[model samples]
Structure formats: structure tokens, C-alpha cells
Target: MNFAKPLPNYLVKRYHGWKATTYSENQVWYRRLATEGQRPRAMVISCCDSRVHVTSIFGADQGEFFIHRNIANLVPPYAPDGDHHGTSAAIEYAVTALKVAHLIVLGHSQCGGVQGCIDMCKGQAPQLEAKESFVGRWMDILKPKFDLVADVEDSTDQARQLERQAVVASLENLMTFPFVSSAVEAGSLSLHGLWTDIGEGGLQCYDPKEGKFSEV
Candidate 1:
């Protein structure tokens, strides 16, 4: 319980710089956000990859997006077992409490979590297969989707396809939640799946009707 530590020097310096410039320039807006609270219109469930900048991609300002980042951006099927479900909890809060109109699952290229899921499913990552490995258990949510891309011959192509599949899988799982589905059925909520190419700075969105992701 004594593991907490002070902020690193670099981060502290960066914070000071941001506070002096960005915070000073937008003090009024920041104060209003503090007093009025956040009323974000959308909730973005994205991978925890540092390269995936959700705000920058959308050109969003403060209090614009309610974002939840996790490995592979996977959402498990609605499980009301009273276990510690961080992703599910975030979704519930966003949909039921925040009442966000749009819920987006954002996946990105070269996702380590997706790669890990692929490797683990192929029996290549023995460590992740261990019962005690949190990452392994979490990646299990995407294991079923691995088979969809397993037939692809090239490793790189396979990984890329699986990354998109990860987004699709999460969107499907989101519908399993009663509140999410109810909101959608009532036309109060919408779901989207997006994939970004980190290297090329390209984006694609899933089209449920076409059954594929198209450039956006």
C-alpha cells in the first residue's frame, strides 16, 4: 500500500509548462468545466497505445470526449456477475449516467494487445496462457475473433485484420448490455467502430451493411 510515489521530474516540468500556457490561455473554459461538470456527447473506447491520440484525431477540446482506454480496446459480453469489470463499468456510466449519444470503439495499427491475442491463440505465448496472467485473461475476450483472420497467409496482414476485428468484436459486445441496446433501439444512441493507421495517419470506419471497414 506504500507504493505510491511523487511525480517524475519530467512530468512535473511538463505539467508546469502546460499549466502556464494552455491552462492560462483557457482558464475561463477550464473553470466553467470544473463548475458545470462534463457533458461529453460521445464516449470513445480505445486501445491504451500511446500513439493513438483520441483527442487529436477528433480535434476535440476539453470535456468533449469521455474516453476509456484498455488493452486491444476489447469489451466483454455483458456479465453482471459483480466482478471487477473496469471496461463494462465505464460503458455503463457513459450510457446510463452520461447519456452519451455515440459510443465508438477505436482500434489502431500494430496493437500489441491484438498481437498478443494472436500469439496466445496460436500457442506461441505460453506466459499469457497462464491463469494468473491478467493480460492473458483479458485478451481472452478477443480470442474468438482470431479464427476469423487465421487463414490469412501473411503475418502483418493477419495482425492488421485482427486489429479491425477487435474493434468490431467490441461493438458487438456493447450491444449485449441492456442499457446500450435499449438506447440504440430507441434511436437515442449509436455505435461505431474505427481503426487508425498510426504510421500513415489514415482512418477507416466499419460499415455494418457492407460488412467491412472503409476509408473515412
Candidate 2:
């Protein structure tokens, strides 16, 4: 098949840089990782947004985290209807196959997906309201959160609240999976919710008892 386009020149340069610096420095380690399968201790579910750097935030090595990124970092409620559910499939693989100890839903400030949810719910984004829009349907998981922060007057504040709410919502949805629930109940797995302030470079962790996000 004929290719549509060549790899971007900037990305090609970046790959060459990786091959020179990090790859050269960690040749043996990289080879070992290639030979031996990855056994990540935690799975990080984050947004597809380029700004949210999961690896950079944790200063993680290549195999340290099994990362899954999707628009808005949302995990919809488990339906088990035999449809294509990428997030759910990843979660199942992580919990059952990887046996990761922690499943972290990492949300961030100024998520376009969350904003889209806000707009679509408020009749601002008609395109998102359409049934055929993947982003719109994906954002439906977070749409229910707008009501949680309905009283917040400021738009940014509302988006922030919804972002945190998205983390909490994904946590709840993860528990809906039988494997996740059983593993959690049997003490094999733990769930955590995290929200990051992209501009301020601050991290806030969810406290279920306080029902708020506090800076970490």
C-alpha cells in the first residue's frame, strides 16, 4: 500500500537524538527490557493531550508504567456488551495480565475533552452532541460531572472541578469491572485518582474521605 505521508522531520530528528543519548546510555537496560517482558507495577490512565507528561511527572523509566492515553483520560462504565472498548480492554489487561498493584486515573487542568463535555452539555458544542462523534460519546462519561460543579460561576473553575470529577468518575467506573473489584476486595489491587495543574505544575491527589483534591 502506498503511504499517505512521510514521518515528520522534527520527530525523525527527535528519534535520532533518543538513539544517541538515552538509548546509548541505557543500551543494556533497553536490551534487557526488550528480551524480558515488561512487569510494570502501576498502570497510568491519562489524557491524550500532549502537555500531560505522565513519564516526566513520575520520572519513570521505560518499563516502569503501563500507560494508556485517551481523550480526557476517561474510563466509561463497564458494560461488557462485547463491543470495542479500548479503555476497558486496557484495564482488563493491566489488572488481569500485568497484575499491576495500582491503577491511577490521572486528569489534568484545561482538558479540551472536559471542556467539550461542559460545552456539549450546555448546548455550546453541537458537533459533540452528535451521535457519530467519537469524542462526544467518549466525553459522555464525564458529562454527568458538569452537574456536580454547576454552581461554580467561573468557567475555568468549572472546568477544573469537572477535571477532578472525571478522575473520580473513572475510579468508580474501574470498580464496576468484576476482575478489578475482586482484586481490590482481595487486597491485590488499589485504585487512585490524581489531577494535575498543567500551568502551575502542581499535583493534587483525591481524598475520598474529604471528597476533595489536595495538593501533593
Candidate 3:
């Protein structure tokens, strides 16, 4: 495919403006981050949703976190497959190579994938065809928990429960990785489950002691 194209006027201006201020205003940060390859303290596995940006939420600058984003932010149990494993590979690098101190599985409210999965499980959504959609296969990872927690009396309640279940399920699956397991066992690494509500602007954390998520 033919490549060069005129830059958008606004983008060109923004790029030049950033460049002008970068070395003087942002030099200290750039120097520190560039001194070494990424040496992040945490790795965040988050949804591919644009609104769910991890670094911005945590006010982190470059190289502060090793991030992996995918549809629904699901971490499927490690398996040898020919298919792309972008998220898995990110995890491997962060845990084994970078040796991040913590791993956070970040899930959020109003997650379309989780809602779609709930609808599919309740027979309200269209059946999946392998040739056309991996929805069925992707959500299959959350099936049992969704079924266990489905709200029979209220549809809205069922949706809320499904979102929560997704977070818990992913956290459990995260530990299935041998590196994660070893780190947790040796107290070198820790796992945290977090849920973000965009509308509420609240960050709730899962509390195993109370078996419920509480506001952070």
C-alpha cells in the first residue's frame, strides 16, 4: 500500500508544540524512563475499551506500568495455541522478564462484553458461529460464574452480577499462571482485583475478607 499522507493540521501543530516543550519541561522524566528499558512496578491487564485507559486513571507516566489490553481483559488459562496471544505474551514479559512487583486485573462497570456474555448465556442474544464470531468462545470462560450468580428476579440485577463475576473469574484465572503462582507464594508479587465505574467515578476494590467489593 502507498504510504505518505499530509498530516492533519491540528495534529501537526500538536506534535510541534509537544516537541518544543518536551526536552525542557519533560526532560527529567524522559531521561529517567529512558535510562533503562521498562522497569515498571506493576502490570495492569485491562479492557480494550478506550475509556478504560489504565495509565491515565492511575496518573502514571511512561514506563510506570506494563499494560495489556484485550476484549473484556480476559486472561485465558495458559495453553499452547497457534492463535495470537498478545495479552498472554505481555503477561509473560511483565512477569518473567520485567518482574513487576504486582499484577492488577482491572475490570469495569458497563462492560459491553460482559453484558453480551450474560445475554448470550440467558438465551437472549444470538448464537455464535465460529466462522463469524468468537463471542461464545470468549465468554465461555465466564459462563459458570455468570450462571451461578444470575439474578432470576431482575434483569438489571443480573447484568450487575455478571460484571462482578467477570472480575473475580479473571483474578482466579490470573493465578493459574505458574509465574504468578510462584510470585504470590514467595511474597515477591501480589494480585489485586479492581472494578471501575465510569459513571460513578468510583474505584471499588475486591475485599476477600468481606467477600464483596468496597470503595477505594
Candidate 4:
């Protein structure tokens, strides 16, 4: 805590401005959310990319969405090892505790995490290939997907294809959670996969019937 000494002046000023503006306008709503706890309608699993703004893109109000962000927006197959699984923990909390109606996995183009996986698979990243690398181990969930898109001739195109597959992979993995699958089968929960093109600001939704993402 000592390293986090004083708050920056600019951030302090911005906090004050927000407190006076949005916070003041929604004072009653904020109070209600605090007292009654959150009942978010949906849980969004998205990449930890600054360019992918889930709330802003969806025009969501505070507490409306239970958002979880991780590298490449991936979800490993349900593994209850009792280890420190941050992403799995968040997913468990959202599905079992929050009981969100919709669980959406959001992926994006030009994802660094996906690119890292590609590099690792091609033996371009020795660091990621090491057993001690946390990121490399985490991205192992995505290594299988590389083969799914390996036919693409272009490297960048292959990366983009892999990125989209990450969403589909997460959706499939979500069903691996017993609680999540039961909820879905009971008509209490639904699953969705989405991809975004940050450079063009385009959004696409995966069509299970069509087996591809189309503009939304």
C-alpha cells in the first residue's frame, strides 16, 4: 500500500467532477443498487482490451451488466481444481451467484492475446513456451483453436480467425459448467457469442445455425 501513496491530482479532480455530475443525478439509483444489491440481466465475458468498451458500446447503466474481462476473453473448460482461477471464479460468481439471465462471450479483432497464442504455437515465443509462463499456460486453452484456423494462408487473417473462434470456444466452455448448463436447459439462462472489429467499429453476432459471425 505504501507504493500507492497520494492519488494523482487530475484523477482526484475527475472523481470530484463525476461525483458532482453523474453520481448526483443518479443518487437515488446508486443508493438503491447499494442497498438491494445487484441484479444484472446479463454477464459479459470480454477481452481486457482498452479499445473494447463493453459498457459504452452497449450503452449500459451502472450495475446493469456483470462484466468480466480477461486475456482474449477465453473460458477454460470447467475445472474445479480449487486453485486460484480468477476467470473461473468470476464466471462461477456470475452464473451461480448473480444468476444472470444471459452469458455473452465477446471477442475482438487484432487481439494481442490471440496473436501471442499464434506466436507461441509457431515457436516464435520461447517465453510463452516455457512451463513457468502464466500467460502461456493460460493461452494453452486457445492453442487448440489455432489448428481450427490453420488452413488460412495469411498470418494476420489466421490470427483474426482465431480471435473469432475464441468467442465460440468460450461459449462452448460455458456449457461445461454444470450450473450454467442446467440453468440454460431450464430456460433460465442463455448463451451468446459476439465479435467486434475495433478498427472499423463494427459488431458481429455469431449464428449457430450458420456457423459464422454476421454484422449486427
Say which candidate scores most in lDDT.
1
Candidate 3 residue-wise lDDT, 1-216, digit = tens: 569889999999999888788656988778877886678999998888888978878999888898888767788877657788776788889889999999998888778888778877777777642435776778778778876666556866766667777778888887888887888999999889888887777898888789788889
How does residue 126 of candidate 4 score in lDDT?
99
Choose 3 or 4, whichever is better by lDDT: 4
lDDT of 1 by residue, 1-216 (tens): 789999999999999999999999999999999999999999999999999999999999999999999999999999999899999999999999999999999999999999999999889999999999999999999999988998999999999999999999999999999999999999999999999999999999999999999999
| TM-score, prediction 1 | 0.98
The stretch of ten residues in a row with the least summed lDDT in candidate 1 is 144-153
TM-score of each: 0.98, 0.97, 0.88, 0.96
- Order the candidates by TM-score, highest first: 1, 2, 4, 3
* Candidate 1: regions farther than 4 A off: none
Off by over 4 Å in 3: 3-10, 22-24, 127-131
Q: Let me know the TM-score candidate 2 reaches against the reference structure.
A: 0.97
Clashes of 3: 0
Q: What does candidate 4 score on TM?
A: 0.96
Of candidates 3 and 1, the better by lDDT: 1
**With candidate 4 superimposed using the best TM-score fit, by how many Å does residue 185's alpha carbon deviate from the native?**
1.1
Q: Give the higher-TM-score candidate: 1 or 3.
A: 1
Candidate 4 clash pair list? none
